[model samples]
Target: MNKANPIRIQRYLSGVDYPQTRDGLVRAAEHNGADAPTLEALRGLPDRMYEGPSGVSAEIGGDS
Candidate 1:
């Protein structure tokens, strides 16, 4: 899914600043209904996708 999509892994964890640790991201992803393994996979994605120059990018950017 697109990184900036509110329902995607990035947006779901963006509120917590892209989580410096896996556990943090997992918790955030759970709130968005992501399964544990899915959350772990998403957490391993590029940090740039989750953290923006500001907050979550207003634009979703290009495809992941």
Candidate 2:
């Protein structure tokens, strides 16, 4: 949570679409158990960060 980056907060709330309502963003953070900083990083992830059916495939396959 780089308290300096408001954009990160905005992105985390709205998703890639548009600025989400404040409440929506708050709920999302709560549901995901994400700290403000972690949520900010997730929001900053590149669009292609996850590819494939569930996005977990890459992580799962990494152990093989």
Candidate 3:
């Protein structure tokens, strides 16, 4: 998947907890009412524990 807009991705992931895995973030984003694009972008994230929003954003190749 290509890089998504960091700001938009973060918006949907606003309620996420730190140190969450990609699957966890997906669930959080779904619960937070993320749209298809946002969800798709999140699903594209690496399958690893993200320390924080910054880490997620960085992995997506965008500045938070």
Candidate 4:
């Protein structure tokens, strides 16, 4: 599968409250209309609270 773009992921994650968990991020991304690959990337995130977008990007190994 193609890797999801971190910048695009962040766009879908805009307005998400900080310190969000992986599940929360998934929900937020879904609400923002993230595509299948984006959701898959989000689902692959470590199950923990994310302090910010950078944390998410770091987890996914992509530059935002």
Best by TM-score: 4
In candidate 1, position 62 carries an lDDT of 33
Candidate 2 per-residue C-alpha lDDT over 1-64 given as tens digits, one digit per residue, 9 for 90 to 100 = 2322344333433343223333344466556465656455444443443332223222322324
lDDT of 1 by residue, 1-64 (tens): 3244334545565467642444565666787777555565655544544344233333333333
Higher-scoring candidate on lDDT, 1 or 2: 1
**What's the residue-level lDDT of 25 in candidate 4?**
99
Q: Give the Cα error of residue 51 in candidate 4, in Å.
A: 0.4
Which has the greatest lDDT?
4
In order, candidate lDDTs are 0.50, 0.40, 0.85, 0.89
By summed lDDT, the worst window of 10 consecutive residues in model 2 runs over 52-61
Name the Cα RMSD for model 3.
Answer: 2.0
How does model 1 fare in lDDT? 0.50
Assess the local accuracy of residue 56 in candidate 1 as a C-alpha lDDT between 0 and 100. 32
TM-scores for all predictions:
0.39, 0.30, 0.86, 0.89
Write the residue-wise lDDT of candidate 4 on 6-56 in tens digits: 888999999999989999999999999999999999998879999999999
- The collision pairs in model 4 are none
Q: Please identify model 1 stretches exceeding 4 Å from their true place.
A: 1-7, 35-37, 43-64
